[model samples]
Target: MDKRLIKRIAIALCVGPLLWVLFLFYCRPVVALHYSARATESIGFFFMIDYATRKQGMEPGETVVIPTPMFPERDLWILLSFPFDSKDSFEIRKPFSRVDVCIGAGAKVERTEIRHGFFDRFTEPREPCEPPTSKR
Candidate 1:
């Protein structure tokens, strides 16, 4: 084998992945205010969008589960927990990892998971907040 060919092969293998990791880290923000996940919003770079949700009037140590706001599909499953209102941000490209994002202010975050068993995954999506009615 030629020395130049071997060196080029090694460089490509190392540099290719390094560039990819960098790209994922520095991607731009893609906002998702709605509670549903949309696949068409991803750019070539990783989904580095900022996501934030808050529920008011919650008890100090109550457990409330809201829909997982749109994150990079690249993640396997998001381990949701309290980031507290003061610290309300998580890494954009990481997946299948524990994210400590804000839930409610001065409220204790107990658990954040699907309210039911695995079958519940197929059920209708509901926002944690009650919708405004004309009468209210």
Candidate 2:
């Protein structure tokens, strides 16, 4: 091989791999972050409120601390808590349903089906009320 041609080939080999690595590390994270944010938005606030109120000991007005995405770049895991409403220390109620978490945008990283603890009776899942049964 010509000396100049060999040098050019060597530089191209090194630079191409380096550029690909950089893109994976940097660009991939940005794409992941955007997808995560969209997923969060799709999970509307109403769902959070419902989860908070349904769990026993969590009053309507209590603050529910929802877990933000751990890695801003990825929306793979989430943690949420519904604290006890009473001034006295009490066992916190688990306020999430596996069905609720599984419902998401087209892409889902983790689908967790969580059940609430003994504080409340398991309510039968209701289909969204439509205008009238006759209409259907």
Candidate 2 residue-wise lDDT, 73-116, digit = tens: 22232323223211211121333321222222332323333343
lDDT of 1 at 22: 70
Per-residue lDDT of model 1, residues 24-90, tens digit only: 5443222222221212221111122234434333333233233343344664332222233323332
Instruction: Please identify model 1 stretches exceeding 4 Å from their true place.
Output: 28-136
Clashing pairs in 2: 98-113, 98-114
Each model's TM-score, in the order given? 0.26, 0.26
- Top of the candidates by lDDT: 1
Model 1 clashes, total count: 1
List the pairs of residues colliding in candidate 1. 83-101
Work out candidate 1's RMSD over C-alphas.
13.9
